[model samples]
Target: MTNHRTGAAEQIAMRGLLGTLNDELGSPLAPEWERAFWAVPRHAFLPETVWLGDDLTTYARGTAPQTWLSTVYADAPLVTQINDGKDPGDGERWPSSSASAPSIVFRMLDLLRVHAGHRVLEIGTGTGWNAGLLAHRLGAENVTTIEVDPSLAIHAALALKHAGLEPRVISGDGAAGFPAGVPYDRIIATCSVRQVPRAWLEQTAPAGVILTPWETPWLCYGLLRLTVDGTGVASGWFSPHASFMLMRNQRTDLRIYRDVVRDEHVPAQSVTLLSPWAVTGDDWAAQFAVGLQTRTVWHTWHDNPGVDGVASRLWLAATDATSWAAVDWDGRTDERFTVWEYGPRRLWAEVEAAYAWWRQVGSPGPDRFGLTVAPHGQHTPWLDSPDQPVPSTG
Candidate 1:
């Protein structure tokens, strides 16, 4: 089947997709963005094969054209590459690259607030669809996008070419922002990062916006929109419910029982009444608060841990492979929960303190907290204002 969207049926499908996206996103799309949406056809940028869900069922256009079309138009992320494009036929490997959900794509672009003639630098040129949109909106010559994966980059370049867009597409480390395109008015990253690279800040024009997904080991990712000051500082607050795949270079491999502990290790036992759910619940605000305090810890939940009664285990491990902790909760018990800690850092203790701080601050959400990236590469998380650092749990 031809990849080009030239047939009458394809045009109709594109229009229907636009209508659906408009309705789902609430009302008419932003005027400028709408034009770009119409100009850049998403179907043109998709790979012949894509993956869906944990099972990673391969959806190939040749076998199921209708399914392919539906998936392309849907408001969901499409995994374009898995296990860094080396998973072969196995679906067990982690997903590495994807076309971000359309809603988030537009949301991040809206946050960018690009003006006419403003130059833009986009990190992670996954499918080139995003670059095509930005190029359509603010002239192809004004947009520059870099992808780390060479194969993905080449594919994106070809796709952009097919779509009649000519934004600069380069293959290199996205963490090292393309300096040739320095002084950009806006910089956006499709991937998440643990630290906002110094190169990104240096490349951005003063007063320019740098938007990316910032993640802490303590919690999930948050969208950070920071404005660069000429004096070598960037400060911004996080938006709630924002997350993305971590940047390749910044991905961590810390895990408990596998990398952090040994069979001979012994943990101190303690019992506390602090309800497990309060800290490890669906409340993102609580999670973000805890993350800010415990900077380099990863956690996981194991439910029904082979116990007689229904019980849940919350495991915490340091990225450095130095400390680990576990909190076990049985549904019947409300007065106390079992906690085990090994290594120097008491993970549960830090979590309890962090949660307490979160409550003391009235359980503020991500928007209430801000981050200031200093010139000397120090990241100081603050509450409400830049000068007031959120009290440390350390």
Candidate 2:
């Protein structure tokens, strides 16, 4: 199996992918970016064995060259690593890293508004494809990329070298950022973060852009693009919906049944008309609002837990695992749901207030919501404008 793409067929596939990306983006791909895309072909960075789709099924380039080539050239993400570099054979395989969908990749490139001779620092050098593109666009010496995983860093470095683009690739924690690259003209993170790292604020040049995917324990969605003021504070709006893997340094692993729920613990019981489905799924706007209001809260749903009458249940827990709540839907009624809350915080009640505030404030989407992070790392989420701070449920 050839590790590289060749011949006229590969060129046609690349052009097809660009057309698909253009249609999805609602604009023809930027001329400069189009050139970068062609030069840094995505398939070259991909491992011979790739994972595809939601289930992360296997697609080997050697066994199925045509299929692998088509999948690689599609406007979609290809899972490059799973289970944090573990084999995960016959076990639960969750995406640890992936090549981002082409549309969003191009979208973020445009969002950065990069200019000639701009020095860019990229966090999360997953496959080095992005770093190669940045190097090609802004020159290799002007781009620096950091990957937390040493193996990934090595692979990405090799791939970048293979592409004839040599950017500075370092293996280090992204949260600390690269102090040596202080006053970076632009800083971009290929990963999502629950909170904006203060180091990133410290390193960005005045009026420079810091673009990253955003996550709240409640949901994973939206990109945050902050503008530096050189005063240690950076304020940014949540734009375009996209979910990237959380930064490796900022990830939390907790299982509700094993780590949170306990049989001996008793919870306060209550009834609510608010359907669990209202804020849990599809209504990303509501979820984003709730996430902002309760910064540390996260959720998961269990369907048909074999708990007799309950058809489904939504479990909510603080990221610290200090407090927890559960809302049960009995299948028959959509209007009424039973709620249980334990620990110091009335988690469900906090949710109700957050939902109410979102409703009262015209139910703005992610784009209208923004965050103002002070130098000390306190996040003040706001509505429409920073002056209108959203109330927090203590």
Candidate 3:
């Protein structure tokens, strides 16, 4: 499709999207930001299509201008590239880049509390939409974005230029932050991270805010907002209901459940019982469970063939060993669990402890917990009383 036709449709979609966002977000974002959103044609930053599952055949792509605009504007995420540089084309198992869903983008923006004239640094410049919005609010000169992929960085630079904005686009590790743009008023990460990178805390200015999704052991994520204190520590709240892609460097562990857990080889009597659903449900409960019982990381997978035909498996692994449990939802709660835990701590116990903490707290939402970071380290605190700190680990 021609650029002109694509631009026109994007403009119309932007207006509609802005209206919906305004209603949903309730004034955290200013009206002027809408202009930047409309000006940047999202389709310009995307590939033709993307894979949705491990299977190469099941995917979504933009075949025409309208499809591109609709895909870009929809509340759903639009995959921009896959498999990093290895396989930019579709039919790949990996998803390297994407225009995050509109709602998630807006949610992060709202959490950042971006305002006119605030200097911002963005990590993971996927689609460059977040940077575009920041540029609209803070001006191109005041915004800088970094991406690890050289090709994706180039595409983002070209897309920003095509939109009539020229933010400094750097091709480097986002975890390192843009040192040249240090002392930023705000730093926002479009990616998920296992731990708060020391560079992000170092580069941020005193009183500046850093917002990113923190990956938990439960396979769930939370938005951590920290206020940097020129030295290296940041403290803030853990926003509720947030998740994102793990940082490229941190995306490890692709082992399947069957390989890790041993039901036949290991005796079932050695395994302890734990509720997988408790960890996969909502925040407070999940976090509580993870903190108390889970000494290690665990993940659950669910597959349903049809009504009453569901299979669920929970994979539990520690920094040292692996074990798992399986549950069949075929009208009977027939479940089997096995363990080969050789680590200092039991993984299943940790999972149960997290759930117990959730119940103890009466199941508080993620918003109730806050995060604080220092050059010394990062901590989660109760928002109501910032002085109280919650223990956080890598």
* Whole-model lDDT values for every prediction: 0.86, 0.89, 0.66
For model 2, the local distance difference test gives: 0.89
Return the TM-score for each candidate structure.
Answer: 0.94, 0.98, 0.82
TM-score for candidate 2, please give it: 0.98
Ranking by TM-score: 2, 1, 3
Q: Residues 1-394, candidate 2, lDDT per residue (tens digit)? A: 2357556878989989988998999999888998999989988888887898898888888899889889888888889899889987888889998989888888999999999989999999998999999999999999999999999999999988888899999999988889887779899999999989999988998998899999988888999999989688899898856899898778888889888888988999999998878888789999999988888888999999788889999999987788899999899989889999999999999999999989988988999988898989988988889999988875
- Residue 115 lDDT in candidate 1: 93
Query: Per-residue alpha-carbon lDDT of model 1 for 1-394, expressed as tens digits?
Result: 2456746766777778778767766766798898888788888899999987877778998899889888887878889998898845534567889888887888788889999899999999999999999999999999999999999999999999988899999999998999997789999999988888988888889999999987888776689999999987999988874678899998887666578879988999998778777877788888888998888877888888786654888888888888888888787777788989999989889889888888987999998888989777788899999988987665
> Which lDDT value does model 3 have at 116?
71
Q: How far out, in Å, is residue 127 in model 1?
A: 0.4
Instruction: Give the winner by lDDT: 1 or 3.
Output: 1
lDDT, candidate 3, at 12 = 80
